[model samples]
Target: MTPSLTEAVAQAWPPAEWRDVHLLAAVSGGADSVALLRALHKLKREAGGRGRLLVAHFDHGIRGVASADDARWVAELAEGLGLECRLGVAAGPPPASEQHARDARYRWLAETAGEVGARHIATGHTADDQTETILYRLLRGSGLAGLAGVPPHRPLTAACDVVRPLLEVTRAEVEQHLRALDQPYRTDATNAEPTYARNRMRNELLPALRLEFGEGVDAAIRRAGQQAGEAQQVVGELAARLAGEARIDGSPDEVRLSPALLAAAPPLVAREACKLAWRSAGWPEQSMGAEQWQRLYTLLCDAGTAGLQLPGGVDARWVDSIVVLRRTSAD
Candidate 1:
């Protein structure tokens, strides 16, 4: 039997975390997001109603006028729920990359949240998304951190938190809840197109996996990601503590690490220490992937290797008992 709306909302843990927090729901008019909006709206009417729920939509400008229509649809959906709706649109056509589009969407959401006094920006990222992300990262040879998949909550900006309330709920449960409500949701035509890798995975591989591994495959994958996420949290804490042990030797623009301490450190600790120095030297964190980090760490450990050039114009070199890093003239 399909789960009820109450059952679906029960998995959303935000209300327990903060009282009187304003939430801005990101609705794309899809079933997942629609269910999120409706559930939150219902919860808003209950006793000790944790906070007010508002709606926000972003038009990527890649889908021609259909994207704009989507914004209108979400606004109307909010109206139906007796909530306020806010819309943001990209200035130009969305960049060719999915990452660019995602970045644009969140950047706008963060900015909107700042303007509207919302404490949390909520999206409809479900357990299925966590599964897909873990699988995708595994295919591309990601490390433990990457395998952790989508986090339930993260800092979107200094003032706002990006939260995924449905991470414990499956896509099947979301559709089932919507069915129980007899609600209407619009489908994005682009989801069927296989140009994107994620679309291909969803359209092709996931079904094959289900067939071969049985229906529990999705749940299993999500569990694996959750375990990885938990393990990564421990690693992050260790990394932070290791970063503290590193000897800071220069200004923020040019950071130097103590070679003697790094060489004496364990491999993992040393890598994290180099990462700390790299950040201190003004390197973009996202630009350093797992392999890139491993390579830099290997270089830091080997006396034979002298220097390394990383993305974002950052350069690192060994100088006797210290390693120095500086940003160069490169984009």
Candidate 2:
């Protein structure tokens, strides 16, 4: 049997240790987020905890009146729960795309968490979201890291982390919990607009897949993600060691690599090491695709290619047996 919302939250993230820590709940007035806020509030109250519970809502300003309504509704909900609420609005028009909107929301969340001194910025990412993310990345030809899917907890900032306490809960469970409480939530019409690739997948592709393959498809994909995550963890450990050995004395803006060392390691580990080096140097990876990583790997291992230019002004060249990567300009 599926666990209750509170049971799922407790099982996924026990609240005993975190009861006294300040939490910033990202409530968008949607069913999932509203359910999350309610569940956390219930858990905290039941634990008789002295922890501060805060609510954050970011309005993308995409839907005009509807967006404003969401913000107001969330504030009211927070007040009803006797929690402090912080509301943020986009400075200008809606972002150009869904990704841009997401970026803006997260930037705001991080800032909010910092200003409020919150330890955890909790979000309402459920199992459905994870499944969607896995499918999305798989369609994009993602590497093992991307295929591993969304993590339950990640750093929003050095001092604050993004947590999903309801990751194990399904959408159906969220709605059922709300129904039992006689609670209402705002719905975004954009979710059904069909213009966004995610919506299209959720509405058309995923349903068709489920119809064709049954519920077992979701289980299979989730299993693959679990296996991929385990594999990536091993790869990350090996790559960290490889990166340590391959990195030459360098400036923060520049990373020098020993091609001999990289060439000696397995291709997968070597490529991951190169990526780690790039990330450690704070180079731009938004534009770096699998093809670019492959090209960099080839340049590092093959003797034919002397040098290569990479995204975010990173210049890689072979100087003797060393591969030098330097950021020539700011991204």
Candidate 3:
């Protein structure tokens, strides 16, 4: 007999004491989320736990009826499972884009979890989501950080940990678990719509690749992400060493690298040092395109005196003996 979802989750958290741990489950009333709730509840009961299980549902208010229905369904499911439920509506002015909406949702979730003193906030991100994220980042020319896809645990703050126990499971497995448990879930019609970038990747890009190339394209990309993640760790270490060697100051917001030191370092280390410098100056990750990176590389290698002002008021200047990166005061 195969291990139940509860067993799998328990195995993942084997070292966890499981007592008095407030687990906040982000439930959208979808099959995946519902399955996560059930599995967590089972684990809580089996451990003879003293902790509280809270369900948080956010209504993005995109679809009129469907959005409300999802929140209602999640509340009902939480009640049925004997878990406390909190419902939050995105009531302020709508965000500018879907990406913004998602960011707001996670921010709200993190804030709520902190308010409730929850130690762990669980999200239902399956292997399929991870695979899609990897492919999307790759297509956007993201380096190691993006290729790492989603991490299993992210420290939301000093207090809370954003955990994804379902990272190893696939969407189909979650649906199967829901079916086995006779759990009812709502499917968002918007997920099928190809307007979103992620939806386009899922529906159009991945399918085409699978049909044209072979099956397991998703797995292949995921494997690549794992390898890239490891390689990125190595590169990050080397970059840190180079930063130390080239440093005139330690403040992340303003970095000054010794041009002589940079010139002596390996090419990859030099490139990553520049990336680190830009990141320290508040530039968004992957904001620099390949051409931009190449141009910056050329500037770093050849020019004795050059400066490039980037978007977001960031500017990189190469003086006589040092490369300086700072955010411009101008808005």
- The best candidate by TM-score is 2
Candidate 2: regions farther than 4 A off: 1-3, 189-195, 250-254, 304-306, 309-317, 326-331
Please provide, for model 1 over 209-250, each residue's C-alpha lDDT reduced to its tens digit, 9 standing for 90 to 100: 999999999989888888988977776677677677665757
* Whole-model Cα lDDT of every candidate shown, in order: 0.77, 0.86, 0.77
Worst window of 10 by summed lDDT in candidate 3: 187-196
Tell me the TM-score of each prediction against the true structure: 0.87, 0.90, 0.87
User: Number of backbone collisions per candidate, in order?
Assistant: 0, 0, 0
Candidate 1 pairs with clashing backbones? none
lDDT of 3 by residue, 74-133 (tens): 898899888899998887776678777777778888888988888888888888889888
Q: What TM-score quantifies how close candidate 2 is to the native fold?
A: 0.90
Misplaced by over 4 Å in model 1 are 1-5, 14-19, 48-50, 189-195, 251-253, 284-292, 302-317, 326-331
Question: Considering only N, C-alpha and C atoms within 3 Å, which residue pairs clash in candidate 2?
Answer: none
When 2 and 3 are scored with TM-score, the better candidate is 2
| Residue 248 displacement in candidate 3 (angstroms) | 0.7
